[model samples]
Target: MTDLAVTLLLFFALVSTAIAIALLRSLFAVVMLSGVFSLLAALLFIAMDAVDVAFTEAAVGAGISSVLMLGTIALTARHEMKPKRWSATPLIIVGIIGAFLIYGTLDMPAFGDPNAPVQTYLNPDFIARTPKEIDVPNIVTAVLASYRGFDTMGEVAVVFVAGLGVTMLIGGSGGFLRRRYRETVLSRKDGQA
Candidate 1:
């Protein structure tokens, strides 16, 4: 199939997964579906020739996140409590934010647009200098680790902070996660009535 066809199919799959995740009450199923969604996203990234991003999504998004969520389920509740009522406030807020984001993207160049700034300058500069200056065989690594080193470092810092926060929340002494686990067990027992 053509690239556009594959992209559309993946987009459909993504939407379907999102809907399933939203509607499911089982946390286990939601976690599994999220992994599937991540894997699909990785495939889409691969199609876009962003192998590094695809690898990261597959490893972190699908692999580590799914495992961590499963561990959380093992420690807490497996099923969600049914809400008494639904609120449209969050939906409306998200819609407004999404609309603004889409509006902001209106002025951006199209994908693979030759006249785009990156295509005109940064890419060429990287292509010319990387061979001699970086001496890296893989251009993607050379570009990401060298040319965009600071940006990559920022991303690493964010991930490190997030992981540290999660560890402290769940692993440290006097952590609230223990209280949550106890409450979850008690709630499940109560629900058995």
Candidate 2:
């Protein structure tokens, strides 16, 4: 009962933050709200007993992504340009996509169903072998690091590239643009004088 309540709270908070992000025009405010959304998602993962996912979300989604977005805001516009006219077409399209996605989930088996594929075969295999094969006390870590090594490496590489891209954006082109702007203005003043 308590977990359900917490889940509901987190779900509502996540929805609220998403709505706020959508409504906000300020890039800074949207970035901060996105961090809030990541945090709520992390909390929800924790509530669902997915500690690894929670940690990843907290670190990647909330931490690095937020900083990168802030750096992007520093490089770009602070406020979204006011649209001349709002259209309902995009919203309607999104609604249609969302409805289709919800419909797709209708065929999914109910949660915790004993006859599920994972419960019947894959999970039992892991439970039986993780102790002897990997010798790791925690099966989740062993599976993530050992069994899913290539996938984990791919994830790491992706994060590294994302960080490198953000760093390059902030320090490379962005710095050059600022310096060029200042020099151009100074040169214009000198030319005028």
lDDT top scorer: 1
Candidate 2 Cα outliers beyond 4 Å, as residue runs = 160-193
Candidate 2 lDDT score relative to the true structure: 0.90
Give the RMSD in angstroms, all C-alphas superposed, for model 2.
3.3
lDDT of 2 by residue, 35-68 (tens): 9899999999999888989999999999989997
> Using alpha carbons, what is the TM-score of model 2?
0.82
Global lDDT for candidate 1?
A: 0.93
Off by over 4 Å in 1: 152-163, 172-193
Q: In terms of TM-score, how similar is model 1 to the real structure?
A: 0.81
User: Which residue pairs does candidate 1 place in steric collision?
Assistant: none
Query: In candidate 2, what residue range of length 10 has the lowest lDDT sum?
Result: 166-175
Question: Tens digit of lDDT per residue, candidate 1, span 18-133?
Answer: 99999999999999999999999999999988898999999999999999899989999999999999999989999999999999999999977999987897788888898999
Residue 116 lDDT in candidate 1:
97
Question: Evaluated with TM-score, which candidate comes out highest?
Answer: 2
